[model samples]
Target: MKTILLHVSLVLCAVSSLQSRTWTEAQTGRKLEADFVKVQGDAVVVRAANGSTMQLPLARLSEADQTFVKEQAETATKPATTAAKTEEKSSGKEDAKKALIGTWDGYMADSDGSRHGDIRLVITEEKITASNPRGGQEMGAGTYKISGKRIDATGTEGQFRGKKYEGIFDLDSKTLKWCSANDNPNSSRPTQMQTNPQAGQFLMVLEKK
Candidate 1:
């Protein structure tokens, strides 16, 4: 029993010794010692050595950190390298995810195109803060998650509290088009346009700043 207890203790120690590395964020040059959690559509989420969670954009990471991501991207390809199509697809997703970092600004509008609001949205590797003002009234500041073109958002405070929203990002044009959900059963969110609005929907068009 004594020998068995000693071996178990040794195993636990080895497991506990597995430590995460400290990573430097590129845009801010801030360092975070953490274990990588996963790569979401637009950011890398990590659990810090101190137990804090963070989300950072790839472009926001330091060059070394970006190199780390490139290495990871290469490493991720090893398993699927046997299939050409799968490799291309994985590479595409990785590229698209990286391009999503930056600040985007534009305007929001109601479905009828008559009423509009100013919009400013900033995206880092891990968090998105979006603000849309209606006639100088701040409706909310939202935090969002992106996967492919799909976006899911939650209002952190204000009247937007307890509300959820959905939207899309057009990666190529650096445009983000998203909206709050319509309350009525038959209605859908508005489509993004440069000039006019669609019916019964609210739309926003923000270009990267």
Candidate 2:
């Protein structure tokens, strides 16, 4: 983390001061008085007083210089840290439950955009049920758990037995969506519904009734 900050500081300094300045690298017992040009990756870019560019490793910098880099990094990340906390508070499990513990209705479509059937969803305190008006197959009964903005369900019986589902709640927490292909045993949690002809569609969305 400190190393990244050191590089960022060097880049900022490069644009602010082109004049040669002295810096002592205590770790290497080296002294340099050069123009700060930029920093790229793990190296600081500088121009020697003789006008030749040089790349120096941040690990060789003095303890004080490294400290300064550390401070800059903490300052830059503070806002992001605060925003993350705010999001967490607003999207906690209790909050997600409020938006999800109810019934919903939607349609299931194939990757070819063909309508599969009209589906009814029933979400309870600890379980979810899906009723397919067309197939008459019981494939949507499962126990569920909610965390943050995610809903995870595991099958109770039938074809869906032992299968797991992972899905996201919309920002408004009104729409639930997940990949149809993710209902496999130990399969990776899907990012979107399958799109390839064999894989089918990208996702399924069910809205509140």
Candidate 2 segments exceeding 4 Å error: 1-91, 112-114, 134-140, 169-173, 193-202
Q: Could you give the C-alpha RMSD of every candidate to the true structure, in order shown?
A: 20.4, 12.8
**Candidate 1, residues 88-180: lDDT per residue as tens digits?**
867876677567778777787655654476777667666566565334445455576666566667777666666666555565567666654
lDDT by residue (1-209, candidate 2, tens digit) is 55565556543433334545566787567788887665556666779877899887767777665565455445555776899998887667666666677877767656765665677678887787878745754566889876655567788866667877665445346676545446644455445444333433245567786
Clashing pairs in 1: 26-60, 26-61, 26-62, 27-60, 55-126, 56-125, 57-125
Model 1 bad stretches (over 4 Å)? 1-91, 112-115, 132-139, 179-200
- Report lDDT (Cα) of residue 53, candidate 1: 74
**Residue pair clashes in candidate 2:** 111-200, 193-201, 193-202, 193-203, 194-201
Residue 168, candidate 2: Cα error in Å is 3.8
